[model samples]
Target: MTAPLAPPGLHTTSLDLGGRTALVTGAAGGIGRACALRLAGAGAKVRAVDRDAEGLAALADRARGLAGTVEPHVLDLTDLDAAELAAAGTDVLVNNAGLQLVRPVEEFPPDVFHTVLTVMVEAPFRLIRGALPHMYGQGWGRIVNVSSVHGLRASAFKSAYVTAKHGLEGLSKTVALEGAPHGVTSNCVAPAYVRTPLVEQQLTDQARAHGIPEERVLSEVLLTDSAVKRLIEPEEVAEAVAYLCAPQASFMTGTSLVLDGGWTAH
Candidate 1:
């Protein structure tokens, strides 16, 4: 059965970000791509940052005719100084770049754990550090961290990912407190498993780690706790990111807007 649409004006987002600029890391694909497109649609010039040159090019093409524009920027987040530099002068920062490696704690590579934290946690700190100056100067800015259910909960074989996300949650709140006096707001959009390349790769790794067929991983693992019984779409998460940046969310800060399909309720 088709669901009824909301009355026209009653449900429109009506967010306008004209003349603003937004920086979305990992914009080459998945949630980052969706966010870059969403912010651009709201008339904000979007800096699409990712190391994937080809993917960035594709995103630039897709953003053509948008209300604002997509500017591709190729940079590895591991370069902390460069990441910070890239964020300067931006009014909006969406720290959506991330990675995951599923392995038992005993077998997880130390190097990989370090890399994950560097990219997901440390880089965001630098980016926010860089953005705050401009934001504080203007007394207005929006910082949206694309965290995960891992930020609030835990699963075996995801130690590093869980740790990094938990840390990100803390960092976001600190920024909120400091930036509040400057008209800057910081928040996190924590979603359950969203349909994306990262999650696709996790299915294979999870199957290997759990000694199960890949086909069984989704039902037996990924969505086992989600009452909704499906993965969220990237665009759906993007809409939540957009809402936080809209004027209506001016008073909301330092907390997470969870899109977890009731996973935490149980």
Candidate 2:
């Protein structure tokens, strides 16, 4: 878990998501949970989707404290019908579900690569296709994809992850262009290393892969590449996701909001 970086006594008021129905994929974990909670906190009726039944239940329980209702749905995003069902009647959709694999290109498993692409790219595309009618009918909608800094740059041993993220950004932009005329907007949030269970697992895998200490992997490998010298907090990403869903954000679309602590500044 990364520590909060926002300065003390400087809080931005959250927008009201009231009366809006939102579907958040990968809502059981990290950035997904933060986005879900933030949307719900602002009064959106949230449907939290995850493959983990128990985790989804726990997330739903947690949302109750935020004075928002979260309905848990356990379904594989690879299933198009399931994705459509989950997206029905949703005013906002957050495509946050994804997988990351670190392996040399020559050793990358074809099946693993295909599956990652299915989830990170194909699934989100299908969800957008499924959700578009409703959004267009209402003349309002928001689609926020959780991309990565890796999408903009290359990294060792991450061919499949990088490919999927880059493809996702293209899809986001294309959708934004198509939906702009319909009052629907598509955008992406690209964050640097976020301290989540998935990232912790990556740290472990990377440490073992490079024969380096875990602390060294974090400090030397992760933070070393970022100007902020720290992992981004999931909440920060969530806040940005919520902002993009607001009425004030209607003019913003088809752009990658890079929150890499200036990792790409160079």
Candidate 3:
């Protein structure tokens, strides 16, 4: 007997990145980890970059059964030279490494702001620079920068994050324009309050900054603007990254694929 067809809206086509090499910074956990696994499942050799050595090892182990491979590359994005070198030969680049500090502009530490910009903006620029030669030579590449709702909208006590994301958004658009003729597509996946370690830590930080209890932080701050009233899963954001890397998204360049749960609608 023949099997029943998939229902409407079901995704039957798999994203195939076989033979491609993908580099995902901050791949030790959260959205970066999910994106690495998703690309590996699509048969792309994933270079998982993170300062967390043990976490990368664990990620590699978990990716063992996937269609492709996950190779751990322990490198801190703060090391600009090394970070750029690491992106060499990569066919797909996912600049997902980031750091966040919750504090008012007046109270925000200068060092932390520099660190955030280094990892989120400067490092990504170098990685893109290093990866461009190969991509342009081959006439094809994918660059997905994992931005955030803060990139488009500002929030109190998140000065550094907002600034860094806004810088990244501009960088993504510039890359898109420059890379278009070379068959490379550059874009940003902007998601709000993803259920990740970063957001978990932000709960406490937000509470402290907002003068609210920890439990109240979720409802009062985090989910207050979210129409969906829930945190987005890392896997959901990973699907967006995968789609951007897929051949089907060739024409979708220089745009923010926002998964903000209507946060930007207001």
Candidate 4:
């Protein structure tokens, strides 16, 4: 059966950002790709940043007919200075780059943990710092952090990812408070188990870490806390990101727009 369509006035609307510039990290794939496309479709010049040069190229190609342009920026977020430099002058900053490892805290590799924190937390801080000068000068900006359900709650094995997300949550709120007087806003879009490469990899890794078959991980682990029995789509999370960047959301900041399928209801 087809879903009922909303009335014209009830339908979602796009914000005009014709002269804006949006920077989306991890834009080579998944949620980042979706955000990049959504903003580009809304007439913003999008800087799609990722270390995956080929993926960025394909993304740039796919965005050809958008209302604006998608320019791929190849960089590893671990290069903090470079990441900050790349974020300079962007009106919208989507900090979506992330990595994961499913292992008990004691068993988790220290180096990997450091890397995750660096990319997910510190890099976002630098990016915000770099973008802030321009945004304050222009008197407007949007900062969206693509966090996870892990940011709010936690699971047993994903120590690094959960820790990084939790830190990101605090960072976002702090920035929001500081940016409020400058017409800049910062918030987090926290979703659970989005159908993205990162989650797919987690499924396999979780199965191994938990001593379960990969096929059982979905029902037995990943979706166990979710009242809804499916993973979210990348596009859905991307739409939430776009909404937060819209003028209508000017009053909304220092908050989390959660898409957890009721996981947090428990």
> Each model's TM-score?
0.96, 0.95, 0.95, 0.95
Which residue pairs in model 3 clash with each other? none
Each candidate's lDDT (Cα)?
0.94, 0.87, 0.93, 0.92
Q: Which lDDT tens digits does candidate 2 get at residues 61-161?
A: 88887756899988898886778767878899999998888788898899999999999999898888888999999999999999999889878888899
Q: Candidate 3 lDDT, tens digit per residue, 1-266?
A: 11122234534236999899999999999999999999999999999999999999999999999999999999999999999999999999999999889998999999999999999999999999999999999999999999999999999999889999999999999999999999999999999888889988887788889998888988889878977777887888898999998778999999999999899998
Worst ten in a row by lDDT for model 4: 1-10
Residue ranges of candidate 3 with Cα displaced over 4 Å? 1-13
Q: How do all the candidates rank in terms of lDDT, highest first?
A: 1, 3, 4, 2
Candidate 4 local Cα displacement, residue 237, angstroms: 0.4
Candidate 1 lDDT, tens digit per residue, 151-205?
9999999999999999999999999999999999999999999888999899889
Regions of candidate 1 where Cα sits further than 4 Å from its true position: 1-12
Best by lDDT: 1
lDDT (C-alpha) at residue 36 in model 2: 88
Candidate 1 local lDDT, residue 46: 95
Look at candidate 4 and tell me the lDDT of residue 205: 85
